[model samples]
Target: MAHYRECPAYDVFAPNCPARLVLERLADKWVLLLIDRLSAGERVRFNQLRRDMAGVSQKVLSQTLKRLERDGLVERQVYPTVPPTVEYALTELGATLGGTVERLAQWAESNMPAILLARQLYDQCGE
Candidate 1:
């Protein structure tokens, strides 16, 4: 007799599915921005990331980075120095998402005008 292993299928739409938790993280605006910014494949300092993201508070950035680190999508390295220099970069798993994240960013930029027009039409219709 031969035995085979079974792989479980996950559906994000299901509340109890672990994939839903991942989807929640990926759907966060800050998480998306951080992933896109780090997609450049360079290790960036916390302050640099803050400046690049503009409008994100330091506290929020710290929290988001911690979450990303916990998720295994980002790697944080701390160098022993005066104040302890810290840098963040995407992990191999995170790098796999870079292209997809970059494409999503491009799509948003490319469709902004159309999106604005649609929003204006919707507001005018007052539906």
Candidate 2:
């Protein structure tokens, strides 16, 4: 079977669409948070990440970091020390995503009141 590549905007269901793959990554709940955390371009240790990302289990963080690293968005460095320290940092590509996510976080912070009011109105209407 042959598929069309001429029009991506019209191929919402196309299995090979590049946009879909990127969207899948961006839609993950932790991607934005991880990106935001690494936005400062500072190397953060594994324990530090766990501390900052409250409620994220060690397993989940490991999996998410693996995925991000595979996608060229994050870098993992292992240093030989007394305990063999491990660090995670964002790559250049991830910083681009970080800027966008930062703006989204800011928007969420600024609009929470209005959003809550809208939600209250919606709940009242349903009742």
Candidate 3:
């Protein structure tokens, strides 16, 4: 593990480094938003997710869902309905993560004003 870090890779955030990949996924707002929605305990259809998360494009949402599904944080179900219904729900792992992510969301909501103030102060300092 230490040897991998000392390899002097050109990109510090190489695939060998798990933190980089996790940060990349967590950095995407859509991913967190999807997690938030799925935490609501109801199976969500594709169209419903789109409506719930306003401004998310179909491609982006699909891509995010795929990533979450791959990570074992979400479960995808396809029913043998007339139109072949597809729904998304959080897995046990996802539910665990949802609790942490929800707390993070709450922290952000409470501290946004302070964060903006800090940003404003930094900008005034001219970098």
**Stronger candidate by lDDT (1 vs 2):** 1
Predicted structure 3, TM vs. truth = 0.82
Q: Which stretches of candidate 3 lie over 4 Å from their true place?
A: 1-15
TM-score against native, each model: 0.92, 0.86, 0.82
lDDT of 1 by residue, 14-115 (tens): 555677678889998899999999999899999999999999999999999999999999999999999999999999999998999999989999999999
lDDT of each: 0.90, 0.88, 0.88
True-structure Cα RMSD, model 2: 3.0
**What C-alpha lDDT does candidate 3 achieve relative to the native structure?**
0.88
Please count the clashing residue pairs in each candidate, in the order shown. 0, 0, 0
Off by over 4 Å in 2: 1-15
The residue-by-residue lDDT of candidate 2 on 3-32, one tens digit each, is 547445756577665657678888887888
In model 1, residue pairs whose N, Cα or C atoms come closer than 3 Å (at least 3 residues apart or on different chains), thus clashing, are none
